[model samples]
Target: MPLRSALAAVLVAIIWGLNFVVIDVGLEGMPPTLFLALRFAVVIVPAIFFVPRPKSRFRDVVLIGSFMSLGQFGLLYTALAIGMPAGLASLVLQAQVVLTVVFAALALRETPTRSQVIGVAIGALGLIVVGSGRGAETPALAFFVTIAAASSWAIGNVIARRIGRSGMTSTPLAGLSLTVWSALVVPLPMLALAFALHGSDAVGFALTHLTVPQLLSTGYTAWLASLVGYGIWNTLLARHPASAVVPFTMLVPPIGMTTAWLVLGEIPTIVELGGGVMLLLGVAITTGVLGSGRRRRLRS
Candidate 1:
């Protein structure tokens, strides 16, 4: 990647890293479902009308929405509400990279190179180390929820790579509109599920509560974080390759931890920091960010 693109990737990284904190802020005054509804609603109104659609079907739009919008964010926020620590959740989200690699090979039938294979193995080990140290002295619902959310994120990443082939990088703002529509549409079935299984009180509680900060945060989450952030990311990767962009995402966890610590007064653990370093190293190796010119050419 060029210096400018690298810097752009880093900027995206900071926005994404701090995104967890923003979610915490947004959720403070709003319930998750209501917050998400408002968030998607903001993206879907005028922007959907103005934004051009990708070269895909309505189902593809739905799939993208499920994977990127609902699968990723929905599970993540739920994990936080359930029991996952903010800093740890930040670290756990990085697991999506490994999941993406696995999904790409399976879904797209694209085999990774030798370096990437090595990178994946080393990265998996690092993740295991980090996960082993999770502060769940006992099994907690939140820890499990966080893992489920991260798994969904991985699945979503595979779905995103599928979208990349559609020739619509600039349409992310449009995609957000499309994604929000899908989010609004698909969760209806789940609404029935939530009512039948979880009952009216849980469903009703998540729906009725509202506050200004939460509402503003929701708009910011969808419009700024999901729309603007993912928009730049899609554009960058469409111009480059996943290998070029994903490495910088490794920077997100460190920034996330830092933001959580400074802003939320959460303490950072040594294991978490180490895992973050290893995670970045794995990404660097996978993406050829630090290799020499000859080696970089060889990898390419």
Candidate 2:
């Protein structure tokens, strides 16, 4: 990947990392489903009118929204509400990296390089270490639900790759347009589901009780994380292979853990710190920053 795209990936990771903490704050005094409804509601209104639709099939747009927006966030928010710590949620969601690689290989025929395979292995080990260190207070149901969320996200990543390779979009800018349009498709279904799952009365109560933290969290997630973050992310995926882009997400767990500690006072244990270092090292290898030079020398 080019340096600019690499930097863009890192930027998205940072935005998404801090996003966990924001979601935790936002869920306070709000039902998870209703909070998601509000976030997507903020994402679509007004902007949808100005942003042109992506140059892809309508079905493709719907698929992106279903998996990426609805499935991913729906499970994720519920997991957090049920007892998943924000920092651990961040780490567990990295399971999407493995899933994306599998899907990309089978669907896109984009084989992973040796370094990437190795990096993923190392990252998986780190995830195990981090998970083992999770406090007993965390619920088993939350952990499994988060795993489902990661799978949903991985499926969404594959769908995105399909869209990018379909020749439906002519340019990277079209990718951003697609992100906005697909996001527009998410809110209605999500709102309906929210009502279906958590009665209208509960939804109404949460909406009426909006606190400052909730409002700010919704705004940040809607504008910055969903709009800006996904916009650049889709653009990068359009311009690069899935293998090149997805590994950058490995950077999120450490950043998420750090932000959680600083903002929420959730201190990390020594095992988590060790796991974080391993995760970073894995990302470095996967991104070609650490091992590429040695590989090139050996090849010569």
Candidate 3:
């Protein structure tokens, strides 16, 4: 990947990493699905009307939204609400990086380079270390649900790459369009689930009692995290091979852990810290930031 795209991916990781803390704030005031529904609803409306649809088929847009937006966030928020710590959730959710690579190789025939494979392997080990050190305390159900969210996100990544490869998403607004339009499939279903699970009374109470912090959290998540973050992310996916793009997500866990420590008081264990360091090393390898420097040194 080019430096510009690589930097964009890093930016998305920072936004999304801090996003876990923000989600905690929003969930304090409302049910998970309700919060999720409102987030997507806000992503629509004025923006959707202004943004043209992606050039892909309407159903493909729906498919991307269902997995990427609805399935991913719904399960994730639910996991966080139920007891998955923000820091650990961030680390665990990176299961999607490996999942995306595997799905891309199988579905798109995009074989990863040897460095990517080695870097991903080391990153996977880091995930295991982090998970084993902290995940024992997490509720079993919440842990599994988060894994499900990762699977859904991985599938969405592959689909987005496929659409991008098809030459349909060539517009500058392609990412924004896909993000806005695909979100059309999220709100109603989430709202229905919210009513069913929480009852209309609880949902209504949460809506009326939305505090300023909660509203701010929702706005950050909707605009910055969902719209801008994902818009850039999807565009980058369209531009680069999945292997080149997905590993950058390894940065999110470290950023998420640091943010959680600062904001939520979730301190990391020694083991988790070590694992995070390994994760960074793995990302450096996979992204070839390390290798490129080595080559430059030899040439000079």
TM-scores for all candidates?
0.82, 0.89, 0.91
RMSD of each: 3.5, 2.5, 2.2
Error of 2 at 76 (Å): 1.2
Cα lDDT tens digits, model 3, 98-138, are 66776777888877789868877886787667666664557
How does each model score on lDDT?
0.67, 0.82, 0.86
| Runs of candidate 1 exceeding 4 Å displacement | 2-5, 136-140, 169-209, 292-300
lDDT of 2 by residue, 1-300 (tens): 889888989999999999999999999888887788788888888778878877788998888888888899999999999999898788888878776776677777877789878877886777677667767767878878887998889888889888888874586567667777877666777678778988889888887888999999999999989888988888777778776888788789888988988898887678767876676566566556677678889999
Best by lDDT: 3
Best by TM-score: 3
- Model 3 earns a TM-score of 0.91
Error of 3 at 36 (Å): 0.2
Candidate 3: where are CA atoms >4 Å away? 113-115, 135-137, 278-300
Q: Return whichever of 1 and 2 wins on TM-score.
A: 2
lDDT of 1 by residue, 132-191 (tens): 665643135665566677677666556665666666454545434444445554355445
